[model samples]
Target chain A: MFITSAYAAADTAAKLGEEAVKKKNVFPPFDPSTFTSQLLWLAITFGIFYFLMARVVLPRIGNILEVRRDRISQDLEEAQRLKEETDASIAAYEQELAEARKNAHTIAREASETAKLAADKERQKTEAKLANTLAQAEQTVRKVKDAALAQIDTIASDTTQAIISRLIGTKVTKAELAKAISKIAK
Target chain B: MATHPDPIKQFAINKLLPLDINGVDLSFTNSSLFMVATVVLTSAYFLWSTGGRGMVPTRSQSVSEIVYEFVAGMLRDSAGSSGMKFFPFVFSLFMFILIINMFGMFPYFLTVTAHIIITIALAMAVFLTVLVVGFGRHGVGFLKLFVPSGVPMLIMPLVIAIEIISFIARPISHSVRLFANMLAGHITLKVFAGFIVSLSAMGTVGIVGSILPFAMTVGMTALEFLVAFLQAYVFTMLTCMYINDALHPGGH
Candidate 1:
């Protein structure tokens, strides 16, 4: 308003008022009359714009981006948790397998030791039975040999008596034959 | 039709609905219409894009998101994360300017940015915010901004005076740059187009001769499109830098 009044006064005094006002630069931007309205509208427009941006639009966009980031990070954490679980299961399986192998080894060693002890017991029992049989066989052989020697003595005595009787033509006495056989046996 | 189409006439403000209260004219204008249109268009675009609220953005959502990130990144680069508090302000300014600038390139649309008053209004807002924030946070210490470190004390007064003058001139330069560029580009386009119109009004020779100006107009239109985007970018970038200065007055 100040600028416009000053310019208007200057224009009239310069004597080029009519022509200057007609042209007026046609640049309505400099027209002080519109400045207030333009300024008023600008304030209103910018105020509303700021409210929309700060309160609604920017916050919405920022939220969307933030949610996406959190989702990605959550997925990564889940993958890590699954990996740890799998590793634990694998470790447990390996531990079980080792335990099974060690059990089998101990069981095999005990079975082998029991079989050896049984075999040794069986062998000792068989050897004692054989020794008893061998002693009985030796005693029977000695009795048979004594019986044969006694029979041979009897035969010789009988043959001697018969030969004496034929050569001398006399009957041999029983008591005499007995005494002679006795002397010869002695 | 008049013999000459006044290029300046295109910039003329007309009262669509006139209202005066207390000796002040408060009227709806063509400028006001376009500005309101820009606001509606921008608001609708953002709301529509975000309405779906998809995790993976749709086309419009992606576009809106890109614009958001672009301004966000600019703020981050200039003022760090602390300066993101002003994101809404800067973004609104950029979108408002960009849409209006592009609209002006169309056949019948008015460029709001072509006016010095509009730009000055916007620039003044940024300048005032910088001052308020700078002083509010730093107290009297904010004056350190005008006085650079390592300056010799003897010439300090002169340097300080110059710095203060430049600081005051920032909003003027900032606003004028955009206003002048838009105003100049549109004026040039209109002038060249006027040449074609006047030339064609003549005989076959005039029609053939209008080819040069026609080609120039086409080339200038293309250049103006680049300038439209460039001026908006420059304004937003400068605003961010100023905000950064306010937030960190120590020049760090």
Candidate 2:
């Protein structure tokens, strides 16, 4: 590339190449062949970047995906297990409920049977008491009929004796009275 | 005839050094400044453009997307599905080189791309990566990349050696392709620009005659702009192709 220079004195123009570059105290414009820093930096930057990407960032992303997959799988499996547990519990409760219903029915039937037996025993006892009461009442009626007959005969005998005394004026003997009374009672 | 670059020499600035601890000569020079500048400009522009993140992209974001899609499309077309894995690498290289080439076109800015060392270093990095990737992926089978099928058994050794030489030469050719194109384009532009100054210095006929070179310069400038973009793309595309060969050796 052509460049214009206004700074060159006659003495400075005489010298060429390295001496001139040094006189100016300027590093000779870098030769492409000898440039080292840029290349080294390139390799270092790329190497670091590669390692970071390969070892750190990518692996982390991959691990996250793997962990997410594992979590989802575990969650699904747990859900299935919980579903089974719930189903089993439901089944167990249903069975227990049925058993309780059966037990309650049996108890109710037995209680009704015991109640029936007690009621029959009470009926029999009451029937026996009524029979005893009827017998006592029949005995009382016979007693009362016999007493009334005796009273009626005694009153007739007395009245007959009184009439006889007025007519004949004689005292009656005990044996004769007894025989008359007995005949009158019959 | 000036012996050394006057404007370039004037432009050189090495104000500060970063490597004081080891005293390892990690001085910040004019090139370092431009390198940092390029990185900053690229990062800032992309970050600012996409930072808002509207679905309907803004202008910078739109440009970013087009470049992205363009590179991605090239990768897919050249390298197939496996190229998706290395998208970030290829994309960064593309953007970096594209920016550097464009920066070279600017009047005062120094181009890192123009430097053979820079281009060759970048190329060698890509080459080494391709080597590592291919070997790492296929192990012994990767050697088959250098050995074609159906070659005569007697000449297979010669073929394999030739293949290795060519494979080794990939980085060189790749770097040279970009380096030569940029160097030629810029030199021609400088010459034509000189002519424009000289003609403008002349009174009247020089003015009219200046249009010929000026028109050619403008036209060539447009063409050079295309070439700057194309060279970066070609370098990146060839890198992908190399990587693809690594991923799927045995010529598919």
Candidate 3:
């Protein structure tokens, strides 16, 4: 069944080829009759396409590429600028931090030095006051010692006179007693 | 045998619209229809795909850009920055041929490039453009293209003659290369396919035999697709090289 049908189709195709060759002896592509039309339409279609590409399509694509490139470069530049700004701010912050640290150290050292100086002055004042009080106490002690020493000498002389008077059997005249006491005392 | 398919019938030009101007037979043939389709599809694809004009391209847009850059780079590499003036022309030709060739791959679709006239028309345009640009840029010095330097004085005449003939032959070879490739590829494919049909008409043994031709047909189809793209590339590459010669004239 398939063989018969295939033969029939092939027969029809051969008849068609014969008819085609009869109608135009030249090959379809080589036929001059179709040349004018093919050339005409090729010109028309290709011309329109070239115009669109040159004027509209290519320029549009070119613009897109240019804009994208510009955008990328711009973004990169902005990022770079921001980075530099950040770096500057960081540097300034560090500098200020260092200055503040230095000031803090100076103030601490000055405060300690002032405190030490004041303490030294106060100590000197206290020491001088103590020394003056000791000096006055010593002068008072020397005067009291001199007065006791004079009293001791007077007591010793009175005892000596009483003893001499008591030893005597009778009471002699005052002038003669005084002259003997004086001799014995000498 | 009478029971065989005619491969040549596929190339027949059917009149879609009968048109005339000043008694010219400018009827819109199947070849013309495919050309129009090629233009429309290419233009619409580029226009629509690039409508968004996004910084990051869509998939279709990427294809468009890739094609654009591919042609641009080809021209630039061959002709240098000075040759970039021909970018639009080269781009159009490449896209037109590439798309038209792809259109031909569809079953029942007419292959426009298979016709010698159309390929000739394209090649002539490039030839004429090169002539005009070469002469316009360098004047009569453009003829220097035919005289290679450092030729032995004794053989210089022969060398120049050869160069002139080869230079003149450029368009013919360029156009015929594409035309013959498309014509021969499609015809060969049809012939192989016809073998399968005729072979399968036999009994069970014949049907199994048909499998070989069928597989061969499949392989040929894939090869035809590659040839379609490769021919377009080759045509455009030759155009670039010709334009490069025109622009330099002194030989790079």
The candidate that wins on DockQ is 3
Better of 1 and 2 by DockQ: 1
Candidate 2 residues lying further than 4 Å off, grouped into runs, are A1-34, A40-186, B2-25, B199-204
TM-score of 2: 0.57
- TM-score of B chain for each model? 0.97, 0.85, 0.98
Clashes of each: 0, 0, 0
**Model 1 misplacement above 4 A:** A1-25, A76-186
- Residue B40 of model 2, lDDT score: 65
Cα displacement (Å) at residue A113, model 2: 72
Q: Write the per-residue lDDT of candidate 2 for residues B1-252, one digit (tens) a residue.
A: 353234334223343554433534444555556666666676567556555554446777667556667877888888898877987678768877887788877877665676677788788878988889999999988988988989999999999899999988899999989877877677777677668767866879889989988998888889888998999989999988988998888884
What would the per-residue lDDT of candidate 1 be over residues B1-252, giving only the tens digit for each residue? Answer: 488766776676667887677868667778888888888888888888888878788999889888988999999999999999898889989998999999999976788888888999899999999999999999998998889889999999999999999999999999999999999999899999999999999989999999999999999999999999999999999999999999998884
| Model 3: per-residue Cα lDDT over B1-252, one tens digit each | 568988887888999889888968899888988999999999999999999999999999999999989999999999999998999999999999999999999989889999999999999999999999999999999999988888889999999999999999999999999999999999999999999989888978889999998999999999999999999999999999999999999884
Which of the numbered candidates is closest to the native, going by highest TM-score? 3
Q: What are the fnat scores of the candidates, in the order listed?
A: 0.51, 0.09, 0.91
Question: How displaced is residue B89 in candidate 1, in Å?
Answer: 1.0
**What C-alpha lDDT, on a 0 to 100 scale, does residue A80 get in candidate 1?**
95
